[model samples]
Target: MTKDANAATQEKLGGILEARDWSRMHEAWHEDVVDHDPAPDQAPGLAGIVDFWKEFTTAFPDVTLEADPLVVTDDFITAVFTIHGTHTGPFQGHEPTGREFTVRGIQVSKFVDGKIAERWGSTDQKGIEEQLQLGTSDAQFVSKD
Candidate 1:
């Protein structure tokens, strides 16, 4: 792809997350897309991807997913991003604490035919739990990459 096409793909990817539009996000993926780092209890494919996002955004309606500066390759994009939001609903079996959290992460998306074919990511789950006053500070997240 040309630089222009890469830029447009990045723009569209970022826009889908920022907009939190489930349908558009699902449509951006290939029919057999694979998410290598889905949330607990999430299955595979576009159905699982959309379901995961729907539940997450439902709990954190005002969440912001900002794509930090990224590196784009011929068929992949690696991004560092921050997810910030307030706890106003149930999350991970916990009731709302009215607290806010900010977690940073990195994701690598591999594309095929201009659609996301696979994804792998890691996030600051410990920090998120701390912010929400859930698990102890010593909590850890097993590597998902």
Candidate 2:
């Protein structure tokens, strides 16, 4: 892909991520976008992507994604980005934590014919873990064992 094409694709992802418009987000991805979670069962697909965003939205209804520069190879494209959000709802079986946080992450994507076909990513889990404990005595489990 040309530089312009790569840039356009990057911008598109930024837009979709920021908008959280899952209805049309799939169109931006390659038909076979891979979800590369630690568990294979959770790795890859349009449905998986949508599910992820749904959960993410629940965790952060007013979230926004900042797309980093895009790197393109003969077939794969990688983009580094950050997802920032305010935790105002329930997540991970936890009640409304009301914690605001921003997570930095990267997405390694494979594109076929200018469309994203696959992707693997890891977000700023450490930052999120810290944010989840911002206030309150929610941590009641104290086991010395």
Candidate 3:
């Protein structure tokens, strides 16, 4: 049961990303889905999910997410994915840098029926900032000779 649900959810996500279809979000997420780690300024529910993706795709028009094999247990599905994109548009109050970045993320989702009811996730924001030369981190790589 859980495996079937996970497969469906994965397929739906793939379709959504591949087509950049925000309208089809309801096919994979419950109407009142809870995102435990919502993006900054992202609202609640499925609409928030759609908005987040829309904003993300706008910022990184060629963004792609590649997931490792999913791990399913009970009603939970865990996915580790790599996100690759170029900063081609405004994002988070910063102008486009025209730089590319690759970051990793992990999400754990709880499925109810066949749709995602709740989720928690984290992405490597610092890595993105460093890659894009954004944010205020002053640390520099030094060689030990």
Candidate 4:
């Protein structure tokens, strides 16, 4: 991918995430895309991405996602982002404390035919736990295998 194409893809993804437009976002990914950081209940492929967002939005109804600069290369794009929201619903079996949390994360995506074919992500989970006043986060979103 050229630099311009990479920027376009990054912007499109950020727009979709900010709008929470699941349907359109689905079109941005390949059918067999893998989310390395999927939620516990999320299935494989696009369905898993949908489910992951569902769980997140359910917990933070007014969540805001902001994407930072995108580091682009020929075959991959790395996005640094932050999510801010109030905990008003269940999260990892913990009751809501009505507290707000700001979590930062990085997602690196590999492109295939101009669509995201695979992704690996890491988030500030400890920050979330502290903000929520939880001893530890038991959210089993990622695979152990």
> 1 or 4, which is superior by lDDT?
4
TM-score of candidate 2 against the unseen true structure: 0.75
Question: So what's the TM-score on candidate 1?
Answer: 0.86
lDDT of each: 0.73, 0.62, 0.78, 0.74
Model 2 CA deviation exceeding 4 Å by range: 1-3, 38-44, 134-145
Off by over 4 Å in 4: 138-145
lDDT of 3 by residue, 1-145 (tens): 5687677776777788679877888888889999888877778999888887887888889988887867886688888888888999987777999999998888888888888889988888888988999975433211000
Over the stretch 72-139, how does candidate 4's per-residue lDDT look in tens digits? Answer: 88788887878788999887677888999887887888887777889988777888888879777567
Better of 1 and 3 by lDDT: 3
lDDT of 3: 0.78
Better of 2 and 3 by TM-score: 3
User: In candidate 1, what residue range of length 10 has the lowest lDDT sum?
Assistant: 136-145
* Highest-scoring model, TM-score: 3
lDDT of 1 by residue, 41-117 (tens): 77788887777677777777788877777788778888888888898888657788889999888888787777778
Pairs of residues clashing in candidate 4: none
lDDT accuracy of residue 96 in candidate 4: 85
Expressed as tens digits, the lDDT of each residue in 1-145 for candidate 2 is 6545655665676677667677877556765665554222333567766666767677778887666765766666666767777888875455767878776777776666666666667666667768877443332210000
| Selected candidate, larger TM-score, 1 vs 3 | 3
